[model samples]
Target: MPSAPSERPLFLDPNLNIIFSVTLLAVLGVSSIAPVFPTVARELGVSPEAVGLLITVFTMPGILLTPFFGILADRFGRKKVLVPALLLFSLAGSSCSLARDFEVLLLLRFLQGVGAASLGSLNATLIGDLFTGRRRTEAMGYNASVLSIGTAVYPSLGGALAALGWYVPFALPIVGLAVAFAVLFRLDSVEVEPGNGLGRYLRDALAGMKNRKVIGLYLVSVMTFIVLYGAYTTFIPLHLSERFGSTAFAIGLIMSVGSLSTAITASGLRYLARHTTSERLITYAFALYGVSFAAIPMLPGHWLVALPVALFGVAQGMNYPVVMSLLAGLAPTEHRAIFMSANGMVLRVGQTLGPLIMAAVFAWGGMARVFHVAAGICIAMFLSLPLLIGRK
Candidate 1:
């Protein structure tokens, strides 16, 4: 007789359950505020250019602080850093709900970014600590899937809340915080050995930076995120608003479709992991993403435009788990957290600069020209795939 699927335990251990909850909450808290940015900016009396700074402020601190947080996770323990980080994130997020001015909101957002960095680096490191080989890959796949779900669901919910008031969206993180607190209380802590001081950490980080394979992965990470996020988050809203007269609700609907695609694909990544090598999957994913970017500017309107964006979402959903799995496999266990943190730092450089670069291109030409330019950069990234594949 075939055993029923429900007979098996959902998690192998209670700790995995706790960790998964923490990860889900952490992602939800960070992403939920994004959909309300347009509404919030209007209420605060800021220009769209200035409102773009919100994205910058949220990510820049992760660029600067993630490395240190990763090291701390290695030296101490993942849970040790993760719990306190979530607490701060929750508090900082609540504080943002109270801000009366753009400057104050930016400051709070920066601190929120710092807390986000700590939570992200440590969460991944903890998974690496708990799982191995195929199990590790599966864990990462599940994590990616949940993260995509948060990204998809939060925007619509945020938009709905924003209809009430801008501050309503900011308060949503408290729900995430409540979930995080539950996980923190239930999870057992893992013990970690002390790491070398700052000097040794710096030496190891520098050594990783010099490795060609590592450098390639870092470049791909930066470029992929810059192109994907820059287009969807920054330009797409503007494009809809300018060309089709999109409102906050309408933009949220478009974003929701992409997020839905990402969530569905991400959920199936574990099955894909069984058939493909991480390097090969990433190469194919990037190629598709590049093609999608190149197609976007060519589309004439929203109905036609969504096809490319949906393709991009599918490519991204497949790509991230593979990229992250490869990175986790490459780093030494002792330094895994720090290595991930460093990768994040590089990604932030891309995140911080991508919008600014897009803004410049938009100024020089316009949105249509800027999309073409972004497509050009993506094509360059696609051409680099052979370099990535050859190394494997």
Candidate 2:
């Protein structure tokens, strides 16, 4: 149950506010540098394709290291893992200012991703630790909303900053240091039991993910990202550029509108959840995404594109909080970090796969077909909702 506003200690607790602000930087870490890639490639005399390694190096490490950090967060205290991770994330992300050599910069970006492994998992784990029931749903919704807001703000911010200098784009995440300092003083430590060993650590993590309930949620997360990001990242820009003659700024502006819509819808999900079970909301959200994706390729003009993107964003926002809240609630407290970490890993896998899968579809067909393919994938999952999860 939610505490009455007057009964609560603060309107928005300072410590939790810090946590939410730091959460915004998680999206910033990788995304803030994206628009600068071509500039970095030109400056360093590297192929743009090779420059793409920046994203891969940064993202791949998280896939491998997040689980390790999850176990560490569980074995040690939250601050023990979080403070160092936050500092490292700030330093590694900001150090692009000094990356005279492209290879060295890749190393720094990889380390930054390693550092960021803790931010999303641990932050949400802390939310899990601190809140439950309606409050828990609200916290997850707010966190997802912040991510949507960051998505809206950062890419264009990166483009603007990159115009000034490639190095300037990385500087924003340095704000994370302030949040780290706040967390150091404000967040409380968790009481973790001793870990058995490496074998048990692996087993326990696997067990949590392997549980019938968790597996469905994990698959849903992966597929949702694949379909959403696949169409959004790979084909949307190409379609807009080719079909509508939109420039980088115009494209960014268009995409940000959807992100803004998502942030608004996700923050209000608490009220939506009151009327509909998480399971039902997820089902409807997936269906909405499917229809939106399928409709994009069929849209006759540029103005119609905006409507589909907004629909997709709202669906994504609605789906994400439910996914996070369910995972947090279902996961056992002792093993919750590992479970959350697994979901993070699954998310990255979907993101990585999304473009690749769509690119294959794009080659076989064309840009318009990418959305149709993605729609098929989304619809398949939407139809599976009945089998995968039940009414809450």
Q: What is the C-alpha lDDT of each candidate?
A: 0.72, 0.76
Model 1: per-residue lDDT, tens digit, 283-391? Answer: 7777777677677667777656667777877887888777777778878777888888888787777777777777777777988776787777777776787685443
lDDT for model 2 comes to 0.76
Q: Which residue pairs show collisions in model 1?
A: none
Candidate 1: residue 341 Cα off by (Å): 1.3
Tens-place lDDT digits, model 2, residues 138-157: 77888888888888877678
